[model samples]
Target: MEARLKFAVALGAALVLPAAVQGADYFVTRQGNDANRGADWATSFLTVQRGVDALKPGDTLTIGPGEYPENVKLHGFGVPGKETLIRAELAGTVVLRGDRDVDLDFAQVPGRRFVYIADCKMDVLSVHEVDTLTNLAPAADPGALEFGPARYWHDAEAGKLYLSTSDFQPATCHRYTIGVLRDHGVDMLQCRRVVLDGLAAAGYRTAVGKEGLLLPTSGFMLHQTEQCTVRRCTAFFNGSGITINSGVGGRTDQPGEGKGNLVEDCRAFANRLDGIVAYNPSGETIRNCQSFLNQTYGARFYGGRAGDAVCLMSDVLAWGNPGADFWTKGGGLSEYNEAVLAERCIALRDCNFGNFQHGIIGGRNVYRGDRPHTIILPGEHEEFHQFNDAHFADPMNFDFRLQATSSFRQSGEGEAASGPHPYKADIYHVKPGGNDDLDGLSLAAAWKTPSRAVARLKPGDTLYIAPGRYAGDLALTASNICIRGRGIEPVVIEGGLRLAECRDVSVERLQFSGPARAIRGGNIELANCVLFGQSVEAEQVEGLRLNHNLLVASLRLVGCSGVILNGNLHAAAPAVQTDTRQAVRYSSYN
Candidate 1:
C-alpha cells in the first residue's frame, strides 16, 4: 500500500495583483500648504501623512528636503511593474522626525545645572533641541540629578519630563521640543510591491502603552508586507532601526505571512537596539548594508517555521557595535530549521552565526577585533573564517574598504571579496597659520578653522589639528572620523563642542574651555584631553571611554552602557555622575 500523502493548504485566497497604468506623481514640500492640490512642487502637500494618504497603486509620492514630524503609515499597494513609490526628491535630504514641538515653563534647581517641573500632561521621551533635533537622555532619578546640559527624565506617574537648561531658560529658550513615547516613523502594513528609497527616519523611542506592554518604536517597520523594497535609506537614534516581521511568528495564513522583501544599500546606526531585524521572514534578501555603533545586534534574522526557503544575507558591514554584529536564531522544531545563506560580510566585533539547528552557509566573511565569535549547535557556522589582523584602510573610523596590500582583496574561486564595502580613506590637517583655501592634505598646506576641517572630513578620515587656539564652536555632523591634536603646544578650543547624531568618533589631546558644553555626543571616545570649566554629557553612548584625561568639570552620562574610566584625574571629588542601569567599569579615578 502507498503511504498516505497530505498537503498543507494555504488559508485565504491568493493575492493576485492586476496590472495597472502609470499613475500621477504627487509632491510634498516644507513650504507648501496641506490644503493644496499636491500635484506638483509648487502646490505640494505640507505633511508627509497627506502625501502618503494620497498614494494608490502605480502612484508615486516625492518629498522635498525637510523634517516631517509625522508618524507616517503606508498601506498603499501596487502591482508587479507599477509599484507604489515614496522617495525623496534628493537622496538623503528628507528626514522624518518622530517628535513634536513644545513650549514649557520650568524653575531652576538651587546650585544645580538642572531645571524641574512638577506637573505635566504626557510622558515625553526626552527634551529635544528644536533647531538641531538632538535628543536628551532621560534622567534616572530626580533626587540624584546629574550635572549635564539637556538631561531629562519623565516621571510617568506624575507626568513630568525633567529638563536641565544651564545655558538658558527653559520657558524663554524657545529652542526645546518633546516627543511622546513609542511613535513609529514609517509603518508599512498589509502593503505589496511598495518601495521606500533615499529616506531617513529618527527620534522614535520605547514606551509603555495602555495595554500594559512595553511598546518599542522602529524607524521603519514592515509588518506582514510582501514584495517590498527599502534601499538607500538611513535610520538612526530610534528604538530599532529597520524591522520586518510577520507579527504572528509561524502563521501560514496570508495576512500573517511576509515574504520576498529586499533591503539593500541602507545604513542603520546609533539605534537603541538592533539595527536591522527580520522576524519570521521568508525568502528575505538583505545586502550591501552598513549597521554600526548600535547598542545591540547589527543585523538579526530569526523566527521562521521549519522548512522555509533559504534567506540571503550578504555584503553587510557590521562594526563599532557593542553587542553581536550579525546574529541568527532558529524557530521551533530545531531539527528542520530555517536556512540562511550569509556571505561576504564583515564584522569588526562579535558575530553569532547561528543558533539551534539552523543551517547557515557562510563563507568569505571577515571577522576582526578581539571579541569572541560564537556559534551554537553542530554545523552552525561551517565556512566562517576569522582574520584577526585583516588589513583594511582605516577600519577604526568605519572604513571597511580593502587596501591594495590586503590579501583578501581578490576573491578565491567562486567566492566574493571578504569585506562589505569598497571606498577610499583620506587624511586632512589643520594648522594655526594656514588658510582655509588650502586642500588640508599636509601640515604645510593645511586648513585654519576647526569647523572647516571637520566639514571636509568623510567617514574613516582623520584630521590632525596643529597646536593652536581656535575660536569657533564645532558642530559635527559626520560619523566615524578622528580628530587628533598635534605637537605639545596644546590644541585649545575656546568654544563649545557638539557631536550629535553620530557614532564611532574619537578625540585625543585637545583642550576645551569656556564653553558650557565641553564635549557632548553619542558613542564617542575622549582620551588625554583637558575638559575644564564646562560640562560633559554623553547620551545613548555604548563602549564609551574616558581615559587618562584631566577633567576639571562636571561629567554626566545618560543611557550609556559599557563605560570605561581609566587613569582620569578629576578636579573635584565627586565630579562624575551617571544615570544608567548598566554598570560602570572604572579604575584609578582621582
Candidate 2:
C-alpha cells in the first residue's frame, strides 16, 4: 500500500498506548525570530512553516498576525485523540500568502515587442508562469488568465519568463488562486484528525509545469486524509478555496485516501475554479458556509469525477458565482447521482441557470431566483433552460432573503419544473371552512384545524394549508414532515404553533400573528413565514433553518446548535438573540 492510503486506514483501529501521551504547545508571532526557541511568544517562530515543521502528534500551533510567504505542507499524521491544531491567535487576521511580487523593471526583450523577466520565484513548478494580474490594466475576469499576469508566457525550454503590461510598471498577482500555487496555504498529505481554524489564505498558486497548464490549487487541501475539520476560515483570490480531495486513486499497490472531513463557517470568494470543492465522495460535510462571486463556480458538493459521495449541505448561502453556486452531478456510482441531502439552503442568482442543483432535495428549502428550476434534478442537466419568475430580497448586494410579499414565498414545491423526473410529492390540504369530519385530503375536503390533519404524515408527507383564518395551534411529532401554504393566498393561524418534541419538522408560507412564540424543536425548519407582533423562542435545535421570515419581535435560541439564519428580515428593534457559543455552522444572520 502507498504510505498515504495505508496511514489513513490505520486511523480506524483503536490504539491502547502503553504510556499516557501528552502533547506540547508552540507559538508563532510576527515579531519573534524563527531562530529562537519557539516555545512562547517571547521566543516564537517567525514563520508558520517553521511552526508547522516542528509539529508533533499532539502539538498546538498558535500563529499570530503576519505575512507568511511560504506554502505549508503538513506532513505527518495526527490521531483524533491527539489532534494537530494550526490556528491563528485571532480569526481572519493571519494571512498565508503564496506569491510575493518583486520590484521589477521588465527588461526590454531585445528586439521583441514584450519584455522578459526571470528572478526564478516561478521555479516552484516545472513550467513557470503567473496565474492572474493585479493592478494591471483591465482587472482579471473569470475563467481566463496568464499563468501568473495581464499577458505573460513561460519558455521553460529556454529558462526565461516574459510579460507585456503596455505600461512598464510591475503588476501584482494572486495567481493560480484556485489550483496550483507556488504551493498551498495549507497542504495536507496522508493526514487525519487535524483542525484548521480562523485564518485567511490568499495569493495561492495552481500552475504545474509538467501538466503544461494552469492547474488547480486549494488554499487548504486534504489528500489521502480523513476526519479533519476546517472552521471559521476564509479562502479567496486563490486557484480554488478549500478542498477535501481524492489523491491519485489506488493503483495495484495502494488505495485512495480522502474522505469524511468537515468544512464549516468558512467564506470562499473570488476563487478561480471553485470556492469550496469536494471531489471525493467520503461522507464529507459543508455547513453554515457561503461562497460568492468566485471567478468560475462557487461551492461544489460533489463534482462526480471519479466517484460520488453522500455529502450533506445545510444552511449554506451561495450566490453571484457567475457560474452556478452549487453543483452535484451524477457521478461514478449509479446511486451516487441521487444520494445527497440538502436542506434550508438559500441558493440564488448563480449565473444564468438554477442556483442549486442536486439529485434529491428536502422541503422548506428556500430556492428563489434560481432557474430553469430552483432545485435542478438529476438526469436532466444537458437539457437545462433558464426560466424566469424567481425573486430575491437584494441580489445586487448578495442578499437572498425572501421579501414579505414575494409571490414565491413558501413555494418550495408545488408544480415541478420541466425535467426527466419531476418531484411527485404527496400534498394534504387544510382549509378553515372545511369540515373536521372529512379526510382532509384536498382543498374542498380540507381540515379545519392544523394539528389533527397534519398528524397523518410519514417521512415525505406534506401538509398544505389554504388561505383561511384557522383556530388553535399545531404540533410537529413526525420526522421529515413538511407543511406549506397554498401559493395563491395566505394561511393565518390565530393560535400560532408549538414545537416541543418535533424532529426534522418544516413549516413554511404561514403568517402567525399573536403574543405566542414557537420554540423547542430538534432539526426544525422555518422558511418564508411572517411573524408580526409575536416572538419566537427556539431551543434544542440541533440543525435549525430560519430563512426569509419577517420577524416583528426577536427570535431566540436557547441551546441551539448549527443554526442557519439567512435572508430573514429582522425588526428594527432587538429582533434576534442566541446563546449558541458553538461555531456558527451555517450561513449566519443575513
Candidate 3:
C-alpha cells in the first residue's frame, strides 16, 4: 500500500503503540491453485478467499492484477499497532467482481426483433457492453427490443436472457457480460484496524428478503468495524457502494464500537442505492471521495447524529444522484441534532437536496442542480454552478475533474475547494498508413486509425488527425478528448463518427461523407466540419453545438436540450428537423 493510503485523519488524540514486527506477505493470482499455500508468487493461491483466510495481524494479502469473482468477508480483528492489509499489487489493476462471465449462444426469437439465449438460470442485473463495462438499458418487454444499441430483458420463469444487437448475427457482431452474483463484494463484520487499498468492486445487486425488502449487498460493506480504512477504491453497479452501518443496532449517543472508521479517496457510481452510506455511525470520516449517478442519495447518513456520533465529510464530489448529493437524517431530538459536518464539497445535477440536511454544519460547498438546498454558516462558504459558464470538464459523462479554465481551479482561503485537478495531457497524432502498434504520442509514430487513437486517449488528451481519408464507423465512448483534423489538406472520414454516451468531446476541421447517427446521449461540439451524411441524427442528447460547419445532410435531433447552431451552412431543404425546444439557426442555405 502507498503511504497516502495508510495515512488517516485522526479525529481525536491517539497513541501509537510499539509496532509489532512486520509479518509474512502472501500473494494471490489467477494462474495459481488453491492447494498452494499463498507463501509467495511461485506458491500463490487461486482464490482471494484462500489468501485472506491465511492472514494474520500485520500480514499483507497482495492480489495480482486480475478479476476475482468472489464474496470476501473480513471477520478478524487486528491489533491496535499491527493492522491487516488487503491491497492490489498495482493500484486500480485488481478488480473484485461480484459477477461471473457467461457465454451466451443466442438465436433469433422467431418473429421478434430480439434474440434469446436459453438455460440462463440466474437473475441478471444487466447485460454489460464488453469494452466500456456499461450496462445496456433494460427493456420492459423483450419483444420491444430493437436492433440498435444494446438492450436486454430477462425472463426469469423461462430461464432465458433476451438481447437486442447491432446485427442479425448477435454472437459474431456483439460481445456482452451478464452479472449473476447478487451479493456483497466485500463484507467486513467486526473487523478492527484493517485497510483496503486500491481495490475495485462491481456488479452486485442485493437479494430480496421477506416482505420484498432488499437485503444489504453493497460493494464494500463495513458493519460494526472500528478504526478500519478504505482508500483509493472504486465501487460501481452494486446495491450500494461503500456502506458503514451498525447493522442491527439502534442509534446511540455514547461512544460505540462503530466509530473511528475512514473512507477516503474512493469513487462510487451507478449503484442501486446510496453511493456511500453510513447508518448509526460514530465519528466516521468520509473525505476526498466521489459518488455519482446512484439511484438514491450520493452520500447519506441515517442515524446516530449527536454527541460523539458526529461524522465528518470533506473534499467530496457528488452529482447526478436523483435523491440528494449529501443527506443527513435528524432524529428530532433537541440534544442529538447534528448529524454531519461537511466542508469543501461539490454537488451538481442533484435534483433533490444539494448538500443540505436538517442537522448539517460546517459547509464550504459548491453546488448546482435543478433544485438546490443548503443552509449558511460562519467560516463556511458556498458557491453555485451557473448555467451560462463552464464549471467542470464534463459532468454528463461523469468526469467531474476541474478544468484548467474553471475559476475554481485556484481557490482563495474562504472558498470551497474540491474535485480533482486537471493536468496537461499529451497530444497524440493519427494519419493514414501509420502503424497502430507504435505509440501515438508524436506525428512520426502516429496511429493508423481514429479508433486506435481514441482507445488510447485519456480524459484531457487530444487526437490530431493528419490530412487524408480514413475509415470511420467509430464508436466513441471516451469523454473530454478533443479530435481535430489538419484542415490544410481536407481530412475526411468515409463512414462518419458515432458518439455513444460520451460527453464534452470536440471535433474540428473534419469531413464526414457517409450516413450516420452522429450523436446519442451526450454533450458534443462540432466546429468547421463538413457533413455529407444522408441524415445526421442526435437523440436524447444533452448538449450539441455546431459552429461554422457545412452540413449537406438534414439535421434530426430528438429529445435534446441545450443545443446551439450558429454560423452553419445547410444545403438540404428543411435544414434542421427536431423535437428539441432549443432555438436552431443557420448562417446560410444552399
Candidate 4:
C-alpha cells in the first residue's frame, strides 16, 4: 500500500504544472458570501475554512483583515516549489476562531487517537449559559414543586475550551467547560499546502484538560501528508501546540511521506507541551522562530531518518523556561545523527539544562565514533585559557593608600607586551586622564606642554607611553590627543579602565594585570595589549570591541578573523580532569 502511495505521488509530481508560474487568488472576508467568486477583494468568503475548501494546486488565498470565528481544515492539496500561499491582505487581520460554548464527550468516540485545532480561537462558556435540569413531583403545598434543581451537571467530557476569567465558579465547574463535548472544535488530517497567516489560537476556558477556551484537537497536528506551510501565526494556552504523530514508537507504518513543510516567524507561548515537535518526518525546516514559557521544551525534534531534518535557527532568544531553551529528545538534535545543527542560539534563565541534549531519559546511543568534529567559538582561534587554578587578591582587601612601589605593582610575563606609560598606576587604578607624582610629579596638563624634557608642547594634548611600570593609569580624552603605546611589549596599564565610544584612540604594547579587566572601550585599537584579570576577583569588563575591532562578541565578519594567546596556550591547572578515553581531542596551535 505504501509503495503504491509513493508511486502515485511521484506520478502526480511529474504531471503537475510548475507551481511558481500558476496564479490563482481566493479571498476571505467576514461577511459570508459563498455565492460570490472568492477571487476579488470585494467578493470574499467570510470564513477561512471556505477558502481552504476552494484551494487548488498553485492557489494563493489572500485573507482580508477581520476576525473569523471558525477552525477551518484543508485536506491534501500541495505541490513542491510551487507551494500554495495563504497570506493576509494588505492592512488587514485574519483570525480563525472556534465556536463558543460547545460541549462533547470524548468517551463516546472509541479508538479516537487525536484532535487538531488550527488557526482559531476557542472561547469559554459562561456559568449562566450552562444548561440546568431539575426533577419535579407534586408538592404538599399547591405552589411548591416536589423536586429541586439538580446540584451537578457535566459540561465538557473530553476536549478543551477558552475562558474569559481565571477564577472557576465552582472548583468542579472546570470539568465541563471544553474539549470533547458535543459540537466542539474542528479536526483535520492529511492536510497539505495549507497556509495559516496572522491567525491567533486563544480564549480557552480554564478546565482540567481544556484549560483555555479553545481546546484544539491539537495545534497543528500532522499524520501523513506532504508540502504544507504554517507561517506568521501564534498558538498559546493549547495542549501540545504542534504535534507530528507518525504512529507508535516513533515509527511510520504509512508509505506516504511528509516533506517540504515550513514553519517560520511564529510565536508559541504558555502552551502545555513543546512549541513545535517534528515526529518521524523528513525534509522539514523551522527557521527564525521564538518560543517561550512553554511547559516542555521550546522546540523538540524526535524520531526521523538520518539527515532528513534541518533546523536553521538564527538570532533566537529563549528565557524563563523550565525546560532547556532548545531540546532534542528521542534521538533528535544529537551528534549521533549528524542531522541537526543549532547555530547562534541563546538560552537565558533556562532551568532544565544547557542549550542541547541527546536521546530519551535512559536511552543513550552513540551515533558517531572517534571522528574529527569542528567546534566553533566566537573568536577566530580555538585556543582557550581555563583560569581555574590562578589565585587573585580579593578587591575588598585592596588598600587605596598603598605606595607607588607596592608589591602589587609587579607585572606578569604577558604584561611587558603592552607599551609603557609615565604615571606609576596600580593594577586597579590604570584609567585614562589622571596625574600622579610617584617617580616625579607629572600632571596630565604639564605633560601636554612642549619643552626640552617632553619636546612636544600644547595644552589638552595626549602623550604616548612605552612598555614599562607606570606610576598611575592614564585617563585622557582630548581632541588631537593620541596616546600611542608600544606594540612589541604592550605598555603596562596597571589599573582597570573604562572608556566609551571615542575616536582617534590607539593602545599598543600594554600589559593590563590586576584584580579587574584591563580595558573596556569601543572604537579603540588594542594591538598588543595584554589584559590579565585579578587572580581572585571576578571583575566586570567587555570582552572585545563593538562596531569595528579585532575581537567582538555578537556580530559576524566576513574576511577578518584572528585570535591572540598571551603565553603558552597548553598550560592547564593540576586539578583539570577529563575522561581520557571518552574525550575527543583536536589540533592545538599557539
Report, for every candidate in turn, its global Cα lDDT versus the true structure. Answer: 0.68, 0.62, 0.69, 0.41
**Pairs that collide, model 1:** 139-152
The residue-by-residue lDDT of candidate 4 on 40-118, one tens digit each, is 8788877777877787766888876555655555555565545677777632145444323344322211232221111
RMSD of each: 17.3, 14.0, 17.2, 22.8
Worst 10 contiguous positions by lDDT, candidate 3: 368-377
Predicted candidate 3 versus true structure: per-residue lDDT over 1-590, tens digit per residue: 46544554231213332233658899998899999989899999998889888999889999887788888877746767778899987666678887667767678778764565545788787666554434567788876676544677888998888777634455445666677766688878778889999999987765534211212578898877888999999998777889887534434333246668899999998777879987776678899898987777798666654345557777777876767777766442112233445655665543222333322222333332211123232331233323211443333333344434444443555544433332233566688979999876555566899876888889988777878989866567878988888435788998777888888899888888876564565668988889888878888777787888888878888877767676689899788888744634222222
Lowest-scoring 10 consecutive residues by lDDT in candidate 1? Answer: 369-378
Clashes of each: 1, 27, 0, 88
For model 3, what is the error of residue 398's alpha carbon versus the real structure, in angstroms, after optimal superposition? 7.8
Write one digit per residue (lDDT tens) for candidate 2, span 220-262. Answer: 8777677888999998767788877654432212225666788
Candidate 1's TM-score reads 0.56
Ranking by lDDT: 3, 1, 2, 4
TM-score of each: 0.56, 0.51, 0.56, 0.43
Please give the distance, in angstroms, between residue 535's alpha carbon in candidate 3 and its true position after superposition.
36
Q: 1-590, model 1: which lDDT tens digit per residue?
A: 12322222221122222223458799999998989989999999999989988887878999987788778887645666668889998667688986565666666666654466645686576565545334456677775554665567778887765666545355355466566646678888768889999999887765435311112478998877788989999998787888887544323222255678899999998777778877766778888898987777788776653236677677787765666777766453122233665665666565665321211112222322221222111223332222221343333344444444455444545544434443233766678899999776655567899987898888888787878899977668678999888645688988767777667888888888854232334567888888875677776666677788888776777777767776688886576788854636443334
Q: Please give the ranking of all candidate structures by TM-score, highest first, separated by commas.
A: 3, 1, 2, 4
Deviation of model 3 at 482, angstroms: 16
